[model samples]
Target: MSNSQQSLGDYGIDIESNPESQDRQDPHTIGILGSADDYAPHSIDREGLPNINGFDWEVQPVQYGPAEILEYWRLDGDFHDGLSHEKIPGSGGIIIRGADDYLREHALTEIEVPDYYTRFENEETHCRWSADGRTHISWRFLKRAVRLSNGYGRIDPVTTRVILCDTGHLFVSGPRGAFLVDIPPGRIFRNGDDLPEPPDSVYETIRGIQVPEENPELRTAFERYFRLLSESPYPSPISHAGFNGADHVLETTSEKTVVNDNNLKVLGGQTKPFEDTVGVYSRQCESTNFVVSVDPMHLPGEIGEEVTLSDDITSFGSSGDTTGIITGYRTNWREEDHIAPSSSGVSTLHFNLIVGLIMPDLTVTRRRINVATFEP
Candidate 1:
């Protein structure tokens, strides 16, 4: 092998088709189309390289207009003895005479996600964000895989891949951890009430979407509500009658409080401990009556900070299409009385919704942080 070439067999990836970035065209990537040509060998120097015809190769251009190149990986090999290569067009069409130079780069190691990269927004086209590249892939890919593969995305760390979760989440060693960056019906909790209809984003009443029908627990867990999603949504089955069903959104019994920081002193009033139902549900809402606490607040008030009922949401019913519980879940973001670092007195209400039956509750927990404000 010349200094420009490597043992292609050593690397398990094939250049003809990149399973990750091949064929599929997203708004950011239209698709990949590469080609190569014959470059006859000349007089051999002791190591059999070039005597002339200087081998050069590039990725053929496909009307991408102009691009701000981020990052790219290259592969090099010969089917028999010809040449192959790829490139980022400065403007358009790629130019390759042989395969030697292409082999000099991009044929090894897995990608560990660079700190900066771009990703397209889930709902909008032509809109991209400059963020930790990992955040972009982590967010959209999961939703994409889940939507495409029957509502779930698989992450295999061993293979450094996040796939749709049909074949048992793929790889034995799942890829890096995945996060829930966003969720649908995002604004519904502002009022804390279940609507007779889901938001337009939800699009329609969910008919029997592709959820599993075998597992008794998972089946019973979904059936009714999802079936109704095919019809319409409801606060409680008894609260209204309609088409399409609803996705599961549960009520939590966690401590939530309204705090304000006029960019100065953190101000908030505290209620008696565990006073969740006093005047929460009936208070006020622009759209809905509740907000969800991913992790409700629980703090040892030595720092003039406390957790109270930010809002109260109840479930409707208990049987058939009606979940029996009146209402559940929320999304209230009143300024924090005080925000702390993850080291001392943190005020974040981490809410975790464990998909369950009857009372899909949002469990709130807090981490001890040491955050404080500054002054002149």
Candidate 2:
């Protein structure tokens, strides 16, 4: 996309649109963005999303190669602003690509928010707002192909109407605003008469939004592309969790809720591949782990109901020392409480582990909701 080709003259029904003349601007809109702020609370650029505590990584275009594409779920973030990318796997028999290595190389080796993408990076700054008189902001969760890989890819961005590049630049319209359009140097994102709503997924949970489909003439006819799938969903994250039912063995908090019991009904456990983000040097961590945020996975039992702990405590991650009980040996999606992609047909539980000299022993525990109502 080029800036020379498209101009401010052609914006769409959603997000920002330069109304030709300054007098035509809305009272709340600010045509120009990226200026010094004075009225906002923090000194930061008053971005729409939370503060980005990260370092920019100039993709080692020469030394580092694009991550070997695979068949696993992953989080692809922007090198500039933090944005979550979920996920895919690769070729060459190697399962875990640890795609985030690109970030670690740039010095992002911490895990603040337990997101499937950065389980260390920032939230997707992928949307912007253009309120009249209000300073406009444009943040993009770039779903890009940073590292050129050497293997076969499972998901490649399909050639659509728009000229999809290695990067998926999301054009935002701010809170509950419009998003998802390419923003290259010469490309002018034309808000289609019909934009499509984003399908619900872990990415949606991370971005904290349900992206709507465009009006029509959706994407521009792109000539070339690199990615398997390209998308930009408005984020709507649950920074907290609610607690209900038998409050006997559950710990509740604003961000998350934990329920534990001795008699958890056993479900299933299987081995799955993942790109670990915790290891320091090793490409493989034997006991590496991952944290997942699941939906209404486990069937909540009645208050004071009984459960039977399953034997298999299943867990999956990379090859390295684990510090937490990422998983023991148990079924992932079959149990409640654990994350299950939330997308249709995907029952795999996402993982995030802490690496150390010693493996963080985990127990992928599971239990039935109501033993009293046990059935065959």
Model 2 gets an lDDT of 0.20
lDDT of 1 by residue, 41-81 (tens): 22222233211111222323221112111111233344335
Give all TM-scores, in the order shown. 0.16, 0.15
Best by TM-score: 1
lDDT by residue (tens digit), candidate 2, 1-376: 1111222233311322222111112212222122211111221122432221221212221122322221212224554455643211111111123223322221101111211222212322112111011111121112221111111222222211111111222211211111122233222334321111111210111133221111111111110000000120111122212111111111112222322111111111211112222122222122433333322223222211222223232122333322221212222212223245773532222222211111111122322122111011
> Best lDDT goes to which candidate?
1
Query: In model 1, which regions exceed 4 Å deviation?
Result: 1-116, 122-160, 164-218, 222-376
**Deviation in Å, model 1, residue 205 alpha carbon:** 15
Least well predicted 10-residue stretch by lDDT in candidate 2: 220-229
**Number of clashing pairs per prediction, in order:** 64, 99
Model 1: residue 126 alpha-carbon error in angstroms: 17
